[model samples]
Target: MRDIPVVLSGYKLTVVEPPAPNTRDDGNGGQVVVTDRQGVTQFVVALFAKLRVGPGERAPKGEEIKVTLLTDPGLGFEEDSRVELVDPRINAYQIDSPDGRSISGISFKAMGLKPVRAPREEK
Candidate 1:
């Protein structure tokens, strides 16, 4: 079994259509420019959410980012599960477990897409 570690940030989520599974060619065909929150436009894929992490400090790798999808707290969540990157900029997302339970966790590092830019204006 392959072990993948991850970090999480607290943020709510709303599901969006999933991306194509192995379609990594960013320049596959005619692309379109899309507007972002920072007032800048760029050619990009439609965004979506996959998980939700609660408020607080980020979790360290190997640490489980607790999530409570149900009204009850007795049912908890695990880390490193398959989560969706709902918002590319913030890395916000949500996901459903194998048992059909829903939970959200920050994709602060979705597939390790780190070194992410700081939206220019902030710089």
Candidate 2:
């Protein structure tokens, strides 16, 4: 299925883990780096997403998701830093096993990520 675009305006994203190279195991017991169609290295960034709550609303709920980036998100994005996903999209996938088991879920991908600066207080 085609990826669905996601708008995150109502949610806050925080980096739970720093960026890391996305790789797969090669047959020779080595790891092969994963890249996009354009040959740009892909990276995985773990983020914690929390829904914004209004007055009298229930407690905020959040979930952690690892996003695949087509290219590096650059510096300044570190663990515990607030961030925003650039051009985020969600794709649904399912894998069937020979043991009659199956796994299905959504995956997240993004063009990049940027740090979200906090608003400055006024005097």
Q: Which of the numbered candidates is closest to the native, going by highest lDDT?
A: 2
Q: Which tens-of-lDDT digit does each residue in 1-123 have in candidate 2?
A: 666999997888999989888989998999999988888899999999999788788756799999998778888888899998889999999999999999999999998998889869899
TM-score of each: 0.19, 0.90
Over 4 Å off in model 2, which ranges? none
User: lDDT score, residue 75, model 2?
Assistant: 85
Each prediction's total of clashing residue pairs, residues at least 3 apart in sequence or on different chains, is: 12, 0
Top model number, TM-score? 2
lDDT of 1 at 48: 28
Error of 2 at 119 (Å): 2.5
Candidate 1: deviation at residue 40, Å? 34
